[model samples]
Target: MLNTQWRVLFVFIVLLIASALIANHLTGRVFNYHDPIGSVRAIYEDIKTKIEMAEESELTAIKTIAAPSLSAKTAMQKHLPQADTTRCVDVSLGKVKYKRNGNIYTWTDSNGVPHFSDEKPDFEAATLDTDFVEPLDYFELTLHAANLPPSFTEELRIKLNTVFKVYGQIIGVDALKKVRLNLTVFATRRSYEQAIKLRGADPTNTDGMYFHSTNSALINYRNEQSAMRTAVHEAVHAVNKAILGSTPRWLNEGLAEYFEYTKNSMQLVSVEPHPGWVNNKRVAQSVFTINWLIGLDDTWQTGDDTKLYASSWAAIYFMMDSNKGKQFLKSIMLAEQKSPCSKLTAAELKNMLYQHFPQLDKDYRQWLKTPFRKQSF
Candidate 1:
């Protein structure tokens, strides 16, 4: 009876040892049991909370940074009043019938009738003839009679600052120094059309002009937004004049178009190649058709006038499309500065361009092939 009792006690002790080993293995502990699950859950919750807090802090920082940079109100006040002016010229078709204000000349028509208007009959359409007189003294900001809305002048000024900032960054210099702009806002289509006629008649004649100066610009205010776009385009012209001085016509128009289409955040969003004589197809056609007659050197000077502006803009766009294009443009500007205006013919300019940038032609051709994608401002 004693031996049987001892055997039962031994078996009971073995069973207890087996149970302890199984528990240790399941808990991943060889010698002791530990509840690691609770600690891991606690760490995970702590990390998740910290991540969310960091995101909130980042948003607060952005707001703080953005608060002080807005100047829409102040910019408007300074620029709106400065842009008002009227541009008119007196012209005589025949002998003077009466002369009022030594600047104004009146004449009689061939039919023995007296007529009076602001401009002379002999003056060509779209041209400013010195023979025609302008009574107003030149001001920095000149607007045609009743052209712009009171609210838009300030907005236009702010946009101008933005354009200059971006342009200066791209060109690596202060472009405003070399260029000055005169903004002309015309209220009615008649005034706008009249201004266009005056300017168009003598495209090459620069006397008694509104925007005839290379360093200066003139714009029509179709609306506040159109006025802004016009400002951007003209501002770029000012920048180009400052940075590159006198550029090839193709390049000049191209760079202007580039800025016209590419400078605004809105423009980049919906960029389509301009069509017709003013843009893409006409420009490309000019290159192919005129390459033989004018050659690449003089192509810019006397190609299809319509395409010249468009193609030039395309070329500028191509150059600004990538980092390489930016660097190449910088080099071109440097080369231009070194070359004297009188000595720099188209051929010499082209040679210099090739010398500095072997890939320019190739890259330009490639840019012509690439599809355009519009961007929002």
Candidate 2:
């Protein structure tokens, strides 16, 4: 009915109109185009849900990480006993709490002595004793002397204090003053055994022990002499821990063995020489040499604990007897203390001996063959 060009234009317009109608229909059906605002609201709701889920997941992760430390603190709190403020001598029963009473207060004097007061003392250097003992300059002595006589307990306390003072001198006054010791003496063997059981240690194996976790030492007092010697032996380990942080296994046991035979008198306290009764017999039978001692491993596990102890003690004794060795030992101790993470390696010990005492190897061999002699501290 029209010209060719006009007819083609009309057909094209009709096709475009039909395509638009189809597109609108498809969009409305598939995309909910009629409720455009609702579609946007659905999308926002999905995003909100995902964000909330992510936050919840993050919160769960945080809780998982924090749970163990919280449980550990709670467990420690449960295991340790509460503090008692009524007594003059406070025992370490868990964390030391310095709660003030009505007007009667407890405090430590400048000399690190604990005292009670109705009014605040005139001393400017007074600190709360119970809290300060474990945390500061003074060592804490918790004596459970329920079965022993009161006089004996009092005397024992004095002797132990003297031991601490002697240890301070050996390590250096300033070094020892930085840390505190926690010593627990069980009055009877029964109580000591009970404590060993509670602590998950073998009573048969351990007569005295130093617990690193709690920074405490435990001893069974059989009599005056035995208790004192044992305390000194354990205290050496404690001193090492406080100052050097880590000591070689041989040196640690060796020092303990060497120091165990201390002679305590009214005038002085000294580390006496070994009588050779405990370890000398074993040491005498074994092939003893400087290189052998240095290279010796499988120390305690090889069922040669007695020999190991003797060898260690003998080595320490030889070194300690010499003035040069004393200075060398002091230098190493100071170095180790300054760097807490450092350990006493075998190489370092050998190198030090070589530097300080070049003929140490020869001297040590000669000393090993000699009989044990009593030397004054």
The candidate scoring highest on lDDT is 2
lDDT tens digits by residue: candidate 1, 206-317: 1112343323454544456556555655555554444445455455555544544433353333334543223333334434321221145354322333344445555655
Write one digit per residue (lDDT tens) for candidate 2, span 1-377: 56988999888667555544544543332334556446545555655676799998898788657654323312211111111122222122222223333345677667998777656766553444443222222445555445556665555455545545554545555455333456667877788879877977655445577776566677777666566556666666665665566556666677777766765578676566655423552244343454466556434433245556667777777777777766777777777666655565667767876787788768876776676665544
Candidate whose TM-score is highest: 2
Model 2 clash count equals: 0
TM-score of each: 0.47, 0.54
Model 1 TM: 0.47
Which parts of model 1 are misplaced by more than 4 Å? 1-145, 174-178, 193-216, 220-227, 262-302, 337-343, 356-362, 374-377
Worst 10 residues of 1 by lDDT: 75-84
